[model samples]
Target chain A: MMTAIDQSEHHAALENARREFRDQLIDADLLVPSGIAGLYGRGAVFEDIIDGIDRVVQRAGSAAHGSGIRRLRFPPVFPRDSFEKTDYIASFPNLTGAISTFEGDNKKHRALLGDRDAGLGWDHHLTPAGTMLVSAACHPSYSGLTGTLAQDGTTMDIYGYCFRHEPAIDPARMQAFRMHEFVRVGTPEQAQQHRDSWVPRGLQVLEDLGLSAAPVAANDPFFGRVGKMLAANQLEESLKTELVVRLYDDLDEGTAVVSCNCHRDHFGVTFDIKTEDGEPAHSACVGFGMERIALAMLRTHGLDVARWPARVVAVLEG
Target chain B: MMTAIDQSEHHAALENARREFRDQLIDADLLVPSGIAGLYGRGAVFEDIIDGIDRVVQRAGSAAHGSGIRRLRFPPVFPRDSFEKTDYIASFPNLTGAISTFEGDNKKHRALLGDRDAGLGWDHHLTPAGTMLVSAACHPSYSGLTGTLAQDGTTMDIYGYCFRHEPAIDPARMQAFRMHEFVRVGTPEQAQQHRDSWVPRGLQVLEDLGLSAAPVAANDPFFGRVGKMLAANQLEESLKTELVVRLYDDLDEGTAVVSCNCHRDHFGVTFDIKTEDGEPAHSACVGFGMERIALAMLRTHGLDVARWPARVVAVLEG
Candidate 1:
């Protein structure tokens, strides 16, 4: 489970490994070729990664539909009403990033506003949207798709920057990273077909780039008692698995390159996403961890980036 | 200086060109090829562009001084005190992005915390850290350099994701973009010399990739009565000029592929950025818009990213 604070040495070790892995990516040219030599913030990298991830998904959708895909991008911040209906905080209480603002006198605002940088203190900041941090790209996509679910199943490949407070860091798991989830809403068959099609195509793309990627059963990082229950449900129903690769011989922090989740009727019932027959539509999605992929490619490939094979470079460039 | 918002049909056309340019880049195999397409915010493309631009500048710095250049990467969000001394809000009053919070009543908090999605509104968020949205990457770098100038002359290359309130839809002029500013601090001569070196190098980069670029004097987009005076002053002093290129023959928005600015002790006086000789240091920076370059590359090369010249592909892959 993700925690707000920690002193666990085991968890600390995992975080160190994650940090080392991040450095390795920079060293490998998959990350900043310049190296991670200075201070950087989670917010900054999160923002950038989110942007890049979104771009790839958008281009992919455009390519698949040639302008037929309706684009709907939501604000990073959303109202609480949306999440309440979805039961996000309740389902994963500990996992939700909930924030509230401080109310102060007008004098406080003036003091802050008068001096470009005054001591307004952390508490003076405004209340943040409840559970604003998107845990998954699909959350926002679902919000955007609430009343727009097509009976024939609409396909949306979206990008979003998501955040989580994990005590440990794995090259496969990031505190913040870009998540590219391709969501499909329709009859169970249609959704499954969409989900399954990606595996082969994704593998083919990897193969073309000279990567040896394999699909595997996996469970997402859920939280507390409810999270465990959610995972159990997913496992019993065979709902999710992520594609993994070992960036290093140490399995302690091997990376997760792709996450494929076949959400059965969970979302259908939640948002009333139904099919032509008015049955709750089944939804499934394929998520690609762009940073992880780049890290994997670099770990598998070479650091100088100049050394990437011509063919592989061609594929990536394309 | 950044403006809150502005929109024109011309802006929309530029946005279209930007989209087309991104598409072309995907086709050229120059990038993994994302547009604002993916599930996340499309801002990743903007971030990637900024990073790419920084890489070019970093490479240039390395070439100039093999390992002597101290590469420093700073946090995007800094302590509010830093901005106060710099007078950023006053100078770029309209452009700064401030983070504020709203504090809710106990009843409201209980109601919000109880609901899954319905949570605190923005009105109750906390007072923002005295931060203006960063209009340019140089602002933070300059602020850091204050009170620590190398009298003899010091050249430092820094990169950061910058934000601005540019309501214009021109892809080239985005609300946020990555800026790679190769900054030089020293005597007037040293600052000017640093700016001069990039002229040939930047052009060579374009030529090597088979693109034509031109250099032109430029003016900052300032607003209000005082802004007009500032703009006039800048013109009189010849402070800003951008290396531009026509992305499309039909589009009026040419890419500002590169920009070189000579701040003649303006920052030195403000932040007390001094030199080793015990005098204030003048500073100058050469900036490259990473996204615009990719756009330029798309225009110069074909969009079938796979077919981009092997040399360029090698650089990107590296």
Candidate 2:
């Protein structure tokens, strides 16, 4: 008994079936358009199915965090005072972003080329290039995992290029994407047993890459009116979940492509970290959403990955 | 005889040997800073030598572009009117970047939380997020190679995540980076024989990736005083070259990890792209600079890629 694809008529028929599956993946060239609305350009067989779903999500996140999950990466900009100490602009200040520039000189680059030749807008000669943008690929690995955290707690394997200004037409609501995550941290019973074992190991790695998924109980578009009682206390304590799939067909609300979360101790008290007994560490994470599972494997096997499913292209070319 | 690492005393002894090789790559944990100044973070042995110099640069760009180039990736923001039709903000407006957001509502998000509680800065409630950051990994594949071309004039390969605000201390001057290129557009004698056959096949692919490169004739930091006469007519029409390398030790000037250039028809008269007998097509590219060849393979193999060089780690793990 669940379905609220956002206040009614299946949100404009799930946004006209995600704008006709993003115009048939930009007419089969596998999405390339960059004329704004969510910025893109992937091609090369949609980046060889996002590099075979990024090497089958790094061998299913190193077989669920064993190779001492460390990897890092980052670079979609960060550090504007470690993104304002992750108060995340008070809960997604309309999906934040910042990186502005033109830090002038030469008489302010000749009045920024005379306000780009009198259009009166050289973006007020830009500014705050102390960086920001990355809105979460595990928010720059919780500022390099602040401090302490050993008693069975520690893992990262992050990634990056994330942003959200929510411009949509649902090519998986991109406004710059890619995520990858994994995270973890520690204690609170190993962060709820590593998010209850990645909510059924992320629906068995998105149903071993061929689709059919589930999970649900999610929440976190949280912002405004005390982020609606902190998104109903993060869905009455379930602490976010996601996974979901239904890439469109009969869309009774799915599109999450992996999440998990858990965050109790909210990034170990905003990264003072702790744990191995000194308490406060519990973080979690999961993530994925790499081009929303390569647009849910080009909306459930089609935009030619040489005809998708043969044991899902042998576990994404094994 | 070229030592202008900028100004001279060999520019503060090549920035004190690139600040002691960025403090021995942030003391061997292979750089993960991000407290701004050319942001960092990239561990797992600095991303496995940047994924083994990105698979020996896609097998030296598919053994020099045979598999019909065409990789495309782009997503470090672009399309702000195709970035002002590549005039490149009148030549690198102090290294560009744009993304801004907080598109108000909820009473401008409580006046952006009362300007972050009167520190008075909600970045003027952001705005122009039509995107813009990537400064070139072949600037969004010349707006998808605009129009005509096919008298053997097309290539592309491409790649991305690039930005350049030049806040340095020479960790290869990264202000957000990564590039890969290959490009070529056609007929101005195939863009001057593809930048004169990649200036000696890019110094023999950086001496088969063990570094120690050469090839100079550069020029481009263009901007004022009529961009110093277009950087002295691009070094008297050599139209850019680069390659360079000497990562440090007694640095007599190097570091310009592969460039090449040769935009003979200035991107076919700014993307009107044409060639198969239509004129206007001549372009070129080359690029590379992926994390300045992973900081010259950790300044010539030291950051223990398991004690590097076994034929340059078997051409980067083959």
| Per-model TM values vs. the true structure | 0.57, 0.34
User: Candidate 2 on B249-287: residue-level lDDT in tens?
Assistant: 666676898899897888688778888777888888888
**iRMS of every model, one decimal?**
9.9, 17.7
Please report the candidate that would top lDDT against the real structure.
2
A1-318 per-residue lDDT for model 1 (tens digits) = 635454375556666766786666544323331111222232223334334434544555565556544333332333344555456544444344433332334454344455424533443333332324456767665544454455466876565445443323344554445666777777888778767776765565456646677777667655455467877777776677666676755534355677777887777787766676778878888887765675566567765556778877655555
lDDT over C-alpha atoms for residue A257 of model 1: 78
DockQ of each: 0.08, 0.27
TM-score of chain B as predicted in candidate 2: 0.37
Clash total of candidate 2: 0
- Model 2 preserves the real interface contacts to a fraction of 0.77
For model 1, what fraction of the real interface contacts is kept? 0.04
Worst 10 residues of 1 chain B by lDDT: B32-41
Model 1, stretches more than 4 Å misplaced? A1-110, A113-152, A159-176, A200-216, A223-225, A248-253, A263-282, A302-318, B1-112, B115-318
